[model samples]
Structure formats: C-alpha cells, structure tokens
Target: MTTLPTQLQHDLQALAGEGGYRDATERDVTEMRGRYRGGSTLVLRPKTTEIAAAIVSRCAEAQLPIIPIGGATGLVAGHIASENQTGVLLSTERLVNIREINSTDRQLVAEAGVILANVQAAATAKDLLFPLSLAAEGSCTIGGNLSTNAGGVQVLRYGNTRDLVLGVEAIMPNGEILNGLSPLRKNNTGYDIKNLLIGAEGTLGLITAASLKLYPSIKDSCTALCPVASPAAALALLSQLQHELGEFISAFELISGQGLHFLREHFPQLPQAISPPPEWSVVLELGSSAENELKKLAESALTKAIQKDLILDAVISQSETQRQQIWSLREHIPLANKKVGAIVSFDISLPLSKLALFIKTAVPKVQDFDGNLRINCFGHVGDGNLHFNVFPPIDKLACNYRSQQTEIRSAVYDLVQKMGGSFSAEHGVGRDKVSELLQYGDPTKLEVMASIKKALDPNGIFNPGAVIDPRK
Candidate 1:
C-alpha cells in the first residue's frame, strides 16, 4: 500500500483545513455492490469547488493519486481505490447545493454533490421535471450520474443523464477548472469538451457542477403491466405502442418470470401487479399533455395489441397507488437479485432486432456451460438494454458456480458481440470492465481514449486502473 508522505499529508490538511481531511472510513472507500474493496489513507470532503481544486492541485504537484467519489452508490467499482492504493477520497457530499433554477428556460444549475432525488424534488417544486431517474436516485449524486452518463428507465423518452445535462463545471486532474456550465440548448462553437469528460468516469476530471435540462411537468401519466408470450411479442407491442402513442411512451421494461420469482422467494412483502404472472411480462409507462387522452390512447393501443395476440393479458393502473405499486415491483427486482445471489451479472445492449434472438441463443449457451444455471433477463427494452443475470441451480449456492465465472461471462458477452451488441451498456467501464473494454472496444476508439487520457491527465492521478488502464 502506498502511504501518504508525511509532508504531503500536512500540506493537504493545511490546504483543506482541519475538518476537510480525515481518515478513510469503510463508507468512503467501498463500492455499493460489495464487488470490490478499496483502501485509502485519507478522505477529503471539500465544502467548495475552490477547495477541491486546491486539493487536486496539491495532489498533482506531489504525484499523488486521487479518487473522485459522490454518494458512493455506484455498482461498478469506479470510485473504489485499489487494494493497497493510497490516495484521498474526494467526496462531494458537502457541495449539495442547487445553484439556480430557471422555470422559464426549463433548466436548473446544480452542484455535483446534489442528490438526484433532491434535484427531482427541486424541479417538481418549480413545477418542472428533471427526468433522469433510477432506483439509486435517493442516494446517488448528480455528479456520479453525469460521470457514468447514467441511463435509467426514462432513457426511452428523455435519454440518459448526458442528454439531460446541458453543461458542466469540472476540475481537471491538473487542478484547472473547465467552466462549461452554460444552460444554452445549442452551442455549436467547437468540440464538445463537456461530453468528452462525461462518461469518462473520473479519469478525465472531477465534475463539480452541471446545468441540467428540465421538461414540462408530466400532465397525464399511465402505467400498465402487460404479459406477453415471448420477447418478440413484447418488441412488437413496443413498436405498436410507439406507432400509436409516439413520444408519450416514457418507459417500456422487459421482465422475465425468474426476476419476479426471485422477488417472491426473497421479498414476498412486495405486491405483485399480476396474480398469476406470465413467464415474460412488460411494464409500460406513458406520459402526455392530457391524462384522459393518454389513458384513452393507451387503452386503445392495448386493445389492438390484445386483438392481434401480441399480449395475453394486462393490468392498466387506475390510480396513483396502483401505478406506484407497479413501479415498486419493477424496481425491487434488483434488490431481490442481490438477496438471491448471482453467479454472474451482465448489463448488455443489443440492436432492438437482435434482442430476442440474443436472449434465446444466450440462455441455452449459458445452460450448456452449466446445465444448472438459471437466467434472469430484464431491463429497459425500449432502449435495447438488458440486465441479463445468471444464477446457480435452485438447490445450489452462487459459490458453486464461482469457478466458472469467466466461462459464464464469456458465453453471454461473446453472444452479445456476435449479435453486434455492446458488452457494457449503460453501466460505464469502471475497473470491473476494463479487460472487457480492452477486448471488445474498437481499436481506434481505444487508441483515441488513451491519447485523451494522456493529454488531459499526464500524471494519471484522476482514477488509476479505471476505464483506460495505464498499466497497459
């Protein structure tokens, strides 16, 4: 483990003041998923961007490493320090301030430390909507969302966090601030620097604040739980809904029976929208200018879908309580997955046309590798992303398949690549997927990423062993 130089520690303390730096706690240096363990001598919680910059500047001068963290809720081990790595964990929790809100422009400027749920609530208070949402919204910070370019259920409508953000203020590895926090909808002056840093995880810089785009408050929203015979039918239903409802289709999720079964086995208290849930089901959510109109269009669309044999049965939510309960079922699957334990988990995206075939072909391939494997496939089907996870046989434990992890992942990812899909979809390539990125990423694109990392962070202190590994 690299130990902080005594002199450098003293310097950092002086720069950040006594309250700024403290010994790293488990909370400061661990990942939410428990997939990785991180170690660091100190954790720095800077109250302001200026102080953050000062800390970065000193770290750069001293050739010390830094890990930029926010909320520490990321599934990938992006913010976790290495096993023996010594560095300062820079937390943005204190920077939790919504700087500005412009209802007229349908935008808001918020600091990186702002909780995503708070941002939603702030926009709601203004009678507007910031639609970048996920299960982690209550704890994940806007900065982490921007860092990973997080895509949630609403990607089918509002796009990812990158789409919701108009501008950002970041501190480069060298402590130089890039003030790109403009709320303009269109600025085609030059290269898109803000985007380059975004989704770069923290290798490029530390995002301090962002100017986010907001939408008009949702007027009429409708939710439905539709049971389909197969994934192909679900895709067809999605097309029909798009053709009929257009942009009103905010979320279209594909769920497998295994996910619901997991919930039933583990989280039985959670209500199931469907009593006798089908093997394959979908959660459809639509929002429009008029609730009554949206409900009519949705009902009409479902009727047509049912008549065409595209859907077997469906439950359209009649009230807010019903809608929330439907959503709760969708969101709780991941928690149940955790309790059940997974042999291997994958976040993959495919061409919409290839999604069904991929699932059909990949499931058997995984079973071929180990006949006892159970697959739980689910995610935002509207955007072609799926959280395809593998579990051991019902009587076995996850540890039973631990030795075959590489084979299991390869079976799924190889199929994903052959079908022209991404091995890593919305989940950014943190340390967990670095090898996969190197193996599957485009050669030229990887070369350019390395060049950008070198040019922007010559010291390689931003986030070592992250998206682009310097060791390579």
Candidate 2:
C-alpha cells in the first residue's frame, strides 16, 4: 500500500482507542545502531490482544503493510517500516502488563510491551531470576527480545530468548489470534508454534504476550576480568574454567585490545579495570546457589590459570559495585564501536573449536581488502557468538571508506561461510541481512522458509521486505 487512506488512522484509533494512534517518532524509523533508517510514519499502539487483532483486521482489508515495533532497540532493521509510506506501524507499547508469575510453574507471563528490566525486577520481587540481561534491557521490550531470539551475557547459562519463552500470544496475518501462551514443559499437542514466532522477527506475526521461564535467584556469584595473551589463550582458559566451574559458569566473554582502545578513546569516564589491557581479555562470571564456595573456587582456579600462564592479569570483582564496573567495561565496547562508526559489523557464530581460527583468518582477509581498516572482535565466547566489527583508522571516519564497504562485507561473509559458521547469529535476519541470508542460506531451507511465510502470511502485508522479500 503506497498511500493508505487517511481514514485508516481514524479507523485504527477508533478500534484501539484514541491514545493508540499517532505519528511515528524518529526512533521508530531508525534502528538502534543508526545503520539503517526507514521513511514510514503512521504508527499504531494497541492496548489489548483484541484491539490488536481489530487493527490488523482493518489493515488486512485495506492491504496495508503492518510493521510491528517494540522497544526499537533492535540492531537489525527489523522494526523499521517499509520505504513506502502509509503502512501501519503497530506497536505493543500499551500491552505492558505482567499477567502472571507462578513460582510453582517456574514461569512468568508477560505482555509483549513489558520492558525486559521490568520483568527482571518482577522476578526479583518473587525471589526468582529472569536470566536474560542485555545493555538495552532497560528499554528493549520482551516483544523485541523474543522477536529477535536475542542472546545476551547469560546465554551461556540459560539460553536465547527462544529458550526463555515457554509460549507466545500473537496475531496471525489474517487477523486471527494465536493464543499459544501455555506455560508447559512438555506439550506435544502440535507443531511448536510458540518457538516459531519467538524468532520470526515479526514477519510471521505480531507477538502480543508471552509465557517466560524463570529460574531461582542467584544466591552467590563471582565476576572476573582476566586479561589473556590472545584469542587462542582465551579459548584455552574458557575450556579450563568450564571444566572447573561447570554449569556454574554463567558467562564467558572474549574482549580484544582494539575494543578496549575504542572504549578508552570514546568513554574515558568508564573506569579501566586492568592496567594496560592485555592483547586480549575475557570477563568470566560464575553464578550459583552456594554462597562463598563459588568465589573460593574461582580464586583457586585463577591462581592455577596464572601458574599455567593462561592469563596475564586478573581483576576479579570483590563487591557488587565493582562487578558492575567490570561489566560496564565489557558492555560499553559496542557503544564505543558505534561512536567510532563501523564500516561493517558481523554478528556471526561458529563451532567452539573454529572460533579462534575464524577470527585469525578473517582479520587478515578484511585487512587485505584495505590495510587501513581496524577490527574489533568480541562477544559471548562460551556460546560461540562474535560481534566482529570493522572500522576505519583512528583518525579517519567510516564515511570515507563507504565505497569499499560492500566488497569488504562480501570478503568477510564468504570466509565466515567457508569456515562453517553463520553470517547472522543472535541478531535475526532483519532487512539488513536479508540478502546475505539468501546468498548463503541453504536452498532447501530457504524454500521451506518461503513455504512457511506463504502459509502464514500469503498477502505479504506482514513485514513484507524483512526476512523474505515480498513477491514482485
């Protein structure tokens, strides 16, 4: 729908209530990383599932594309509306409610618009843990998190957004409601529709609410910043720590010296934990119910690792404030990357054994494309996901290198494919990576995905150009 009828907004307002319809904010059009922006403006916020269904029904009749937006913290261009104006931008913001928290069930039912931090706070109130933590958790909504199947620091211990969700309540493309919000461990009733919508990036449907799994609140924990010699050394240290700490090992993050330099350059206010950060480092965290025992174990293990020369220095947190500071160092690297402006960033994953090798090989390959490019490689090493980003030299801006961006991206992605890794890991194949998915995706898999998209959203009105492009 190139130009929707102006009456459509009033029709949606009447359906979802006056407060639900409004012009889109700038944030609504731009993705989190500021890499991509859209031009649509019609925004709709429905309060309830019934109201959401009604809005979809009206759009379906009018054949208007409906872009479902959440907290708009997505790195991919998933939430941005189409290039053409007049598509209805449906937001789940008004669906902010925690309908249930059952300790016995070990689950919490949350509306799609509930801020992830709010859900964590609610679980904390119940003396339980939500286990999903992200830099954008304070603003990213549950809907977007689930939509992207987001991965964060705790994915090593728990899992991705799909792993945390038990069920979801969504509106299908034909304006029908999919009420699959059942908090069950084993419900072999049919196809796992809940998991289907969890990572579909809203191309499949507009998720309204979800039933999420919760865990026991961590009783005791330890956070450490261990500086290693190289990515290979960091991988070796991770193997040792996992053997020693086992499931208690909650997060194992790999950081590059380049990332630290970026941090110091951009965010000088953030306290540097280690002196002259090593060539590589890792922020290792352990969480468990046993008090004091985990820290003793960690301290002992770190001593052994030092003796083995696996780590050069260690900055273990002794207090909550200090732990947050250490984590702040890890979390702020991406912000620094954005400030420096990456020419191209890759969110790719490989087998645990292939990680160090891929990093080593991909670096020189990207540098070969242009020797002036500097790379920042880091992320959740425990889970094999790496946010490998390429940027310009310290004195240069990314815009100056824009002409070479496409070739550099292709070189990196081809290597990622040849090394038996994924081009898109935790970040879903939003509009940004849609073509990459098509280029590297398995033919059979793409065919099946197209089939599913056709079955669920035949009209192509549901996020038409996102995961799969609409028919010409």
Candidate 3:
C-alpha cells in the first residue's frame, strides 16, 4: 500500500461512482488541534451503507489502507492517515440521518454522520435528553463520538459514549457487515462485539449507525460556580452535594486558577462566573423533573457546605440565560487553552482519593522539569478525569518549548501512573498516545487486543496506524 496502484484506483473510482471519489485536499488529511497531518491521495464519500461496503470491499481486495474520518474534530490523530503510507480517506458526512426517535422506548437511532448537536435537538423535541455532550458537539458526529468513546461534562451522571449506545451497525475491515443495531436492554447472546467497536477508534470497524439511549427531559435545573480552597475541598463539596442531591447531580467540574487566568487573558469580553477565581473552583449542576425542587436541593447543599467552610463563594444561575452563560465559561476553558498553546496536553484519570494529592505533587514536579512552563489543570472531577496541560510562560510561544515536550509529558504521565491513574481517560490511543499505551498498557490486555485485531483485520487495511499498529 505504499503507492496507490493504477488498477486499485480504477476499481475505487468504479465502486464510488464519479462524484464520490476525489483527490485528497489538505483538509482531508489534517487533524484537529493542528498537531498531526497525514498523506492521502484519494477521498471517498459513499452515500449509503451498501456503497460504503462496496468501497471497503474493493480496498480490501487491493490490500490498501483505509482511514475513516468523521467531522475531523478529534483531538487525537485517530482519523489521520499515516504519512509514510498511501491511503484513501473515507468520510461518513453523507450518512447523516435520524431514522427513529421513540420517546416511550427511550431510544434514538442515528446515522454515523449526524452531528451531536442535532441529535440533542431531536431528543429535546421529543421531550427527552441525549446526555453525551462536549464543546465539539456542534461539529463532532455520532460516529466519531462512539468511535472515540467520548466523555463530557455529564459523565458523572450519564457515563461515557459507550454507556449511551445500546447497539451499532458497522463494517469490518475485511468488508463484512456487523448488524448488531438492536435496542434491547438485555441480550446475552454471546461476546459484546458492539462494545468492542464502540471504542476501537475504527481499528476494529467503520461504524455506520447506532441505537442510542436517551433519558428523561430536565424539567427543572440549577447551575452554580463554587469557589473552593483546594482540590480536597472540592471533592468534599462534591460528596456533600451528591449525598444530598443524589441522582439529581448532573455535572461537577473542577477548574484551576491557571485555567481561569487563561480565560481572562484571552476571552476578556466574556462575563466572569466567579470574579477573582479562587485557587480552585467547581461548576456544579443539578437537574430533575420536579420544578423548584432541583434548585431547592442545591441551595440546601450549598448552605450546609458554606457553613462548614467547604465552599467560600458561590454564584447560582437565576435563569436559563444565566445558566447558559455559566456553562459557556466552563466550555470555553479548552478554547482558551488552545489560544495559549500547550507544550503537552494530558487526558488522565485518577482514583477519587488520589486526585487532590496528584494535582498538588505533579504541578511543581512538572514545573521543576522546566521552570518557565505554565500548567493548567482542570476537568470533570466528579468522574475522576482531568485535563492536565502544560504551556510556556506568558511572554513565550509554545513553539519555543517544543524541545521540552518529552520531558514535560514524562513528568506528568509518570506521576499519574504512580498515583494509580491512567494516562488516557477519554481521548483514545490515537497516533499521539500509541507509545504511551505501549509503555503503560497491561501485557495481557495488549495480547488480547492484538489477537482481536488480527482476527478481524488481518490485512491491516482499517485505520492502519491507530490504536494498535499493523504488524511489521
């Protein structure tokens, strides 16, 4: 597959028809975050599952690598084709369709190319909720979300993408179709192959559609910005809220002072949720069907926490507009981080008891590797995931610190491992974290993964270099 053979190109053109095939552009091969670029000669956009199957079947016969991309909003280089190899890009953009929405059954069937925001709107129209949410929801597609097993603000309550999806219909690397898109709650027929493909990052298969689980609509809700003295206090406050609010607690996110500073520095026009942000703050939200009950429960929890000095300052949203403004602050932290580029960004997870200590120890230890580095630590603390990013000093550019990337990454990852945490939490092991996975991954787990990959994709034509590399 080093070069696209003439016969293979002709076969692809014939299979995809005239308009479906085109020369790859810069946009086709580049990833989000501008960190990875790939080399692809041809791009294919098939309109139907049958057409996609034809394209994959032809490529499988030619033994050419195929890279699957959706929305191109992934942070990891999962969708980026290998630069050293010649491949074809397969996009699911034309597959956008919402086949079904059953409010009574609490399920929605969506095609791979349906944008996440549109899914949310559809659920809203049915008086239901699709709880998988993130800043990239506007552009990220359902296929991409399930592929990456994406996590977002509400993971504390609804879980990740894997939990939201009940079934999926995907095409195996060898052009075999797996039709497991059943909306059954309990099906113990055999091994859970649907779960395998959900988080495989397209290494296992190219997902075409899914049957997703939806939840009851939020009739009443409350959003608050709580300033705490430390991560320890933040966790304690979360515990208090959950004890009182129970399942009503929807989201609890941790924000560090450094992240707030980045927001103030870059997005000055945005209204601040909590002025003069504390050393550490949390954005807490609660939702319920009973109007006024959610806000009342939240207020009671905060009143007790404030009395105990667990929370210092707080701002509760009084209206839907204000609530959106508060969430805007939480969502824009990543944008601010992008504006002030990072030397290395980590999506790590830790045990609840270990989060506070890990943050305290890792910040200074990472900075010791390079005194001028700026660390921004924040994430969905309720679910034990953290986005720990390293940046250059205010006056310096990220490019200037490129040489220290390895050192910075090693410092953070080592600490995370030592604290009984994972190097990757939500973002999958794309090209960027392949080495990290090899280093930190369990040997037995790796062996099983390789076995599965070999059995399903023996020719190594599916997302060639992602998750697990092709055999040499």
Q: Candidate 2 at residue 413, lDDT?
A: 91
C-alpha lDDT values of all predictions: 0.89, 0.89, 0.88
Candidate 2 global lDDT: 0.89
lDDT of residue 168 for candidate 1: 91
Per-residue CA lDDT of model 2 for 356-442, tens digit only, reads 899889899999977878999999988999999999987888899899999988998998898899999898888888889889999
User: What is the Å distance of residue 355 in model 1 from its true position?
Assistant: 0.3
Candidate RMSDs in order:
1.1, 1.2, 1.4
Q: Which candidate achieves the best lDDT against the true structure?
A: 1
Models 1 onward score TM values of 0.98, 0.98, 0.97
TM-score of 3: 0.97
Q: List the residue pairs that clash in candidate 3.
A: none
Q: Report backbone clashes per prediction.
A: 0, 0, 0
The sequence of per-residue lDDT tens digits that candidate 3 reaches over residues 113-142 is: 999999999999999999999999999999
Q: Which model, 2 or 3, shows the larger TM-score?
A: 2
| lDDT for residue 270 in candidate 2, whole number 0-100 | 91
